[model samples]
Target: MQTRETFAGLSDWQVGLWYALVAVSVAIFVWGALRLVLKYRRGRGAFPTDNLFRRVARTAWIVLTHTWIRRRDGVAGLAHALIFYGFVVLFIGTAILAFQDDFAEPVLGWDFWRGPFYLGYSLFLDVFGAGLIVGLLIMATKRARNPARLDYGRVDGVGSRYERWRYTVGDWAFVGSLLFLGVTGFLLEALRIAETDPSFERWAPFGWIAGQGLQAIGVDGETAASAHFGGWWVHGVAALAFVAAIPFTKAVHMLAAPASVATRNDAARNRLVGLPPNPVPEEIGYGVVADLTPAHLLQLDACTKCGKCHVACPAAASGYPLSPRDLVLDLREQAEGTFGVRASLGVEPLFGSDANLLGNPIRPETVWSCMSCMACVEICPVGIEHVPI
Candidate 1:
């Protein structure tokens, strides 16, 4: 009696249609992810497997604890932790619901999503849902204030100036989308509670309170039902679209960041990577995109454009052209154009096979500007190996 109705008012055909859309979303996600993997594989050296298990465990600990994210700005670190954990809990909640509907009750005949379990689940999700919104607000506010770190202005000014603004738009759109999803999620829950006004629904504290407000405003009965129906579709579609777009968008950091952290040489600053037994002139340093190691390629995507590296870089501080942040970004643009999804789409600044990174976009002057200072490597939250690159 205390459980939710899966797919509530939808007919059999509509439910089937929803599943079809989910399939399309998942297929696109997988394809985009595979494309990224291939793009990384196009690089020179292989992904490191040395001490992988220990490295992975360490990565998980670091990522879960948000240790790297919180280093310079405690507020941003807290905000990120809130968003990360909230999304995780909400994701698990959705999975649990799906498993019960699609497998447990129907196939195993063990329906456990009721009573105490349902109550606890509702309360957990409600709290995290609110947390997600709060975290997004803090981030949006930080961006609005135009802090020095978050500022995307170009000091080197190699590529199109509009490129930086496009990145700005993408960052805002990312935050906006997550914010929109969080708000609509609560609204959906509120609408549902207002429609039925069930006593058990009090477990979802935020939704319950919002539902009461809706009822106070005379949004109940048929009006609530109509709104819920429309909203369910809206939220469902947006959620699916967000999932499918993750790998193709800035959200790729969700995957790339973890991999970058895991693969990063913990002692890189102290013991720089040794040169080849006898290096050729062509192999002295990376001249082209293909010469970048797989870890470097992955690091390019792992960058959140946080600018911590830029701030910490001595080269940048001295007004040199070498912003480690900009270097990675330029490499990223080149990598994407050469081998990644942007190449497939024929986006501007497209690179051909063996495209010379040092030729354009990345200037030889910028490379020379670096003093091999390890500040960028040390301060990078996502584990980009700036000194090595």
Candidate 2:
């Protein structure tokens, strides 16, 4: 490995490009985070905590223990954690790569940091990537069989084809992207070792497999090197694209989840309690009627559409007119639908005269069908707390 410090190891173009990417990612992350935090605090007026420490302790317990979601989602919960935590670990790995490219390599004069760091990293990648891959496979299989076995065909109230299709495509895209990223990373490592550094072969099992395959191809040293670099490009590009796509894709929840956890209300986990009273005389509703706030829209976007909520929804199982998944999906649709209306008709607040807590346009059965069991709330990985309408 080259003993080159930081971005100095990278050519000027590579360094500049990496810097730009990291800058954009950080900027977007910060903006979204600040907006969510501010909105949450503003929406829930500040007050002195009576059991500040205890409340925090309980929140920690709830999140770390995952007592609620685990109980409601069961295997689906475990699968979600595998994917969620795997991505978390993957993020750390990516950060390390960034530091190596941007800081460590330049500062430490070493491209490859051996010993404990590298070993631990390799182990993390193998385990977490395996977990993500396995979890996704289970999820995909479940999606395929869930509809048929759950008798969706007979259930007239099941979610629409468009919603199902969106979910399936989103899930597959995320899975495929992650898989390709991991696989190509290993391939790059293997090629690097076979061509330039055989020592890495001992610590990198995945890479060794790729290197062996390269040797089988009977390519010359130059060809192998080119192929290896090409693979690295593919891996890096996929990773970059995944990052860019986050705010615009279902994967956005990966980032929103922590914030959701921090701000989520346990009591409201399974209901849509009316929004706090709008003190304005002209105010029309309690919750969103039209022109939902950015934060509300964020929550809608954070939905993974995994149907864990649907599984727990009494309405879904009882042949009623409500499914929690469909509810959120409908809210999203309403928001989108109102986008045009908002500009012309002005925002219609959903409280006061306009308020219909019993589900108004959404249907009364849909509102009452919720058991308020908080099962849907408990099961949502993103901490979407739905309560009585």
Candidate 3:
């Protein structure tokens, strides 16, 4: 006989509410994403679209394998890989469940949430969810233990902007969201197991353990059912909020990073692309955010702020005012206008300041500090080219 769980004990009204929340979340995400696209479109130059097939294949390989990240820091890279893959698998599992609930059971009159296949899926998700939590914990611990590890070295003359402070709020928020998702997910599963008292509880080993704990505390079926419904709503809303927040936050790097890698220059690594013959003198190097190409703007958005570029930079290590990560962040601030009052007004000339990048945000000394060694470029896992920029 097949078991019927009523999809985590949600009522018809609750289901409708969940769908409404999802719609709103998706709309917010789409609007934010479109705004970002328009910002990129405002950039100066065109992106190369040559070698279509090659680009696609390269992007897939880099994103899937995370080869660039793995090449630099093995332990951190492995943790990142685990977190990434775990999230992917969990997302896929959620999609499958949605398909089963909304389409398969109603329209097709079929359900796959039974027998060996369902058991395997449950076990897989359980294991990966735990792995994801562990990976996040490791990253958080590293950040806490040695904050200077992110700095690489200190800047001599510059103040707070060049100095590596603690992790930003965005960093904490991103990590916190993931941790909440993982924990709440397992809690929801445990509640479900307690409510349903499934014979196949053994298949979901983690959930089963949680359910046994709840039972030891004398949680009745009625309480378990109520808790399951509450958890369902909380987890669902949190998941949707996290998705909606992506385009507006540093989390967008999840998409931008691989893209920066895949669409990176195909020519010689160190060789700089020469300017067009008889070009205007003013068109030499990037002076401001407006001078950059759309692809360059996208690269700016793609930065993970890992500070590996700063670490590898000879200039930064030598106590010069320039940190490659700081340069990128400054440019990004100008591009996005996340800091100033002009941003809230939705005014033109993104930076809104008459002074060029050379004075305030980036000093002449800082620009001169660069040795053109390509050390930052070579070490950047996301393929950011600080020297060229």
Best prediction by TM-score: 1
The candidate maximizing lDDT is 1
Worst 10 residues of 3 by lDDT: 338-347
Task: Show model 1 residue runs off by greater than 4 Å.
Answer: 159-162
Better of 2 and 3 by TM-score: 3
| 297 Cα displacement, candidate 2 (Å) | 5.6
> If the candidates were sorted by their lDDT against the true structure, best first, what order would they fall in?
1, 3, 2
Q: Determine which window of 10 residues in candidate 2 has minimal summed lDDT.
A: 1-10
lDDT of 1: 0.89
Q: Estimate each model's TM-score.
A: 0.98, 0.73, 0.91
Name the candidate, 1 or 2, with the larger TM-score value: 1
- Per-residue lDDT tens digits for candidate 3, residues 31-135, read 777777777777777776889789889888877887878766887788898789889999999888888888998999998877777888888999899889888
- Model 1 clash pairs are none
Displacement of residue 102 (Cα, Å) in model 2 is 2.8
